[model samples]
Target: MEHAELDALLTPEAMTLLDGLDPVQTTNDVARVVTRLRAAGHGPELVSAVVGQSRLRHRAAAKFGEFAGRMLFTRAGLEQATRMSVSAHHAGRFARAGLRRVADLGCGIGGDSLALAALGLDVLAVDADEVTAALAAYNLRPFGDAVEVRHGIAETTALDGVDAVWLDPARRTTGHSETRRVRADDYSPSLDWAFELASRIPAGIKLGPAHDRDALPEGSEAQWISVDGSTVELVVWTGTLARDGVGRAALVIRGGSAHELTAPADTPDEPVRELGAFLHEPEGSIIRARLIGDVARSLGAGPVAEQIAYLTGDADARSPFATTFRVRETLPADPKPLARALRERGIGTLEIKKRGVDIDPAEFRKKLKLSGTEKATLFVTRIGARRTAILADRLE
Candidate 1:
């Protein structure tokens, strides 16, 4: 957003209009509101800002829940903001370690700062972008003196008197709306500096879940978190916040419940064995944390193939760490024969899952030419030295 639009949107008139309007969800709603606001003599800047924010509020609901209604956001900031549920867990680490003051450097839209302050910890939220910093201040206004928002570079932010720090360095180019990812070497508050700071203070540094594990600092706990079914972020904990003897952790959150699997280090891969009665697909976070062996042991299972993530077992075990599927039979690996086999069984509504194979599920699905009322899952993966297709049903 431009400074003029932001300045105009902060006024009493514009804010009241934004709050009073019905939920803006569709393009039709946006057009209707824009026309009405313009007809009512509202300036182009105010109308554009209010309507744009209305659209953003609708999108922000998935992250902030009901709190999105009263908050402000920039397009790029909203995209990078941490989900409330995950940020609360980050805050819990600090609170559990008896730390009360936190410096949330690069606090995009105050997502983490909001969680920190809600737990009664004093927070100094800093953002390098002036507009984003302003938006953070407005979003965190409800916390009163518990939170302080500042516009500054994270690398130079003063951390004096703070018990811990939360670093979310900028991983993308500078912009309020459109931006693109940059190389890790180009990250603001370079990893070298961030790691140095964490060594000196109790800190939590959030990074992409797929970040190079070999580049991670020693003596820090690396935790990979997945919400619903998507692996979201990897957090590195240092100093007192880092749990003793725990170097790897996987946290899986689905709906209202959460489960965690932790180990001193990445567990060795379970031995590969012949196919069994059931196949298990580990959650993305577990795969990212390299703790698949632990989950496999818990279920009395082993890998379906060497270096393959799929696990198979004879026991009917259920776990939050992985999804279980009952193997029905093996089908032809070739698409032509597979389609004929699927047609013979009258299978439709197929969920195609593939790994360790070079094929697009969507394009492969089209070749099936399916027409049926039944449903099943097809696993196109490698078994030993050959590609294989397994037909199965998901066990809820």
Candidate 2:
């Protein structure tokens, strides 16, 4: 970020410059007017206004960044933290589940740490950056009395015996931001590092939902956790871990509904796609736990193809594994003819779901000129040796 860029984003000092407010000045006007006030000497009134808006804007941006982080990191793009509020039962569940005496390895702004503390858990949250650590401490101050914020790299921190350790590794490389990656071995607190600690005590490691299954360590309970139907983070549990028939669980928050599903673990070298009356793509947890079979069995569904995560059956199934989309029509895959047919059907809104094949969804939608028509599910995959797209609608 350059100095000019920094000016665009409010610095702590820039925020202090806007003081006081008219009861009537809207937030937008305050920000815009504050920009002008910066040129004139800042008075006590202007400074107060800036501080008030500063607090609001800081919190909003932090919330947004955290939301984006959770989405991109999860399999189903789950929203971990939100203004929507936490579930009371879910809050107590983590506490009842022996997550107390917690060690939040990378407590980014204390989102999880705060949630844990709210449930009466004693959290020893740690972070590497002095700035972030300070900010985390400030954010967590409201939890009061129970939470202790520390500053250090968790990989090097001495955690002799904690009830449960949370390993949220830092993926940012030395300089360039694009250097972000998900190398288990290279994280500041690598997966191996977390797993090694977990081997000693109960530990939960948060990983990218798009992780490779072949790389998972033995003797760990792998869970694909989702919130509100969207698969969020992959949780690896070691010690006291159970091999749930299905690895994927739709973790319903608070007093809301919760669904736990599983999938069969697949042999990577022998990949296959399952098709049926309804094809349910189990969440990552189901895939990693290799419990897809368990989910299909529970739903009375069968595999469309042998190894593919997709399941099929003559009956409509209610499973958290996948959204139920009915087969409105089925035909062979031909881009030009399919587009023409769709255009005639007045179907312009498309959701291209791809599995075995590699075709860009955006490019396909653009080429098809999808707009102002209708919504439909497009499945692009390979059957035998050819790839095709099947347009369908929600089953129920």
Of the candidates shown, which would achieve the greatest TM-score relative to the real structure? 1
TM-score of each: 0.98, 0.74
Residue 67 local lDDT, model 2: 35
Q: Give the deviation of candidate 1 from the true structure as CA RMSD.
A: 1.1
Global local distance difference test of model 2: 0.58
Error of 2 at 208 (Å): 1.9
TM-score between model 1 and native = 0.98
Indicate the worst ten consecutive residues by lDDT in candidate 2: 69-78
lDDT of 2 at 65: 42
Question: Each candidate: what lDDT?
Answer: 0.94, 0.58
